[model samples]
Target: MWNKLFVDHPRTVQESYGEHAVMAASFGGRMVLAGLACLVHAVVPGLFVRTGSRTITVLYDEMVVNRNRKANKAAGEVAAVGGR
Candidate 1:
């Protein structure tokens, strides 16, 4: 199932650099590394799923109020500075 999600592509720009065996090899390596990263990203979410009802709603609401207060203070300070 997971194998179908990963689609690999070759590095085409490297081929234009030089007509040499080493360049092609490095291009292939880059493609492999990119493919590996994509595969890891796809599978990682399933592996690290936090299974539970989130109970931080009140805390988040408090944080929003705190953030608003701080923003208002900063804006007031900016206005005072500009006024002077």
Candidate 2:
């Protein structure tokens, strides 16, 4: 149960527990800042015109695109080895 709660997901993502924790925390912090910026923009009308969108784009690239790339690469390697 502990491994399932703490280790499995991190291992699947090729990260240690500590590494995953730090990465998740960093992303969470960035999201909070982006949300604040968007809130400010909503009231001010001009500031942070691109901040929210830019943050989403960056986070998507980091979290989705890169993760898919890594998973695909690992899968390909396993397939190659199995084929040999």
Candidate 1 per-residue lDDT over residues 1-84, each given as its tens digit: 442332221122212223434544654665565556556656785631332112133334644675587678778999999999
Residue pairs with backbone atoms closer than 3 Å in model 2 (clashes): none
What is the lDDT of every predicted structure here?
A: 0.49, 0.94
Off by over 4 Å in 1: 1-55
Candidate 1 residue-pair clash tally: 0
Model 2 regions more than 4 Å off:
none
Give residue 4's error in model 1 in angstroms: 40
* Candidate 1, run of 10 with poorest lDDT: 7-16
Clashing pairs in 1: none
lDDT of 1 at 65: 77
TM-score of 2: 0.79
For model 2, how does the per-residue alpha-carbon lDDT over 1-84 read when each residue is reduced to its tens digit?
Answer: 999999999998888999899989999999999999999999997999999999999998899976888799999999999999
RMSD of each candidate relative to the true structure? 18.7, 1.9
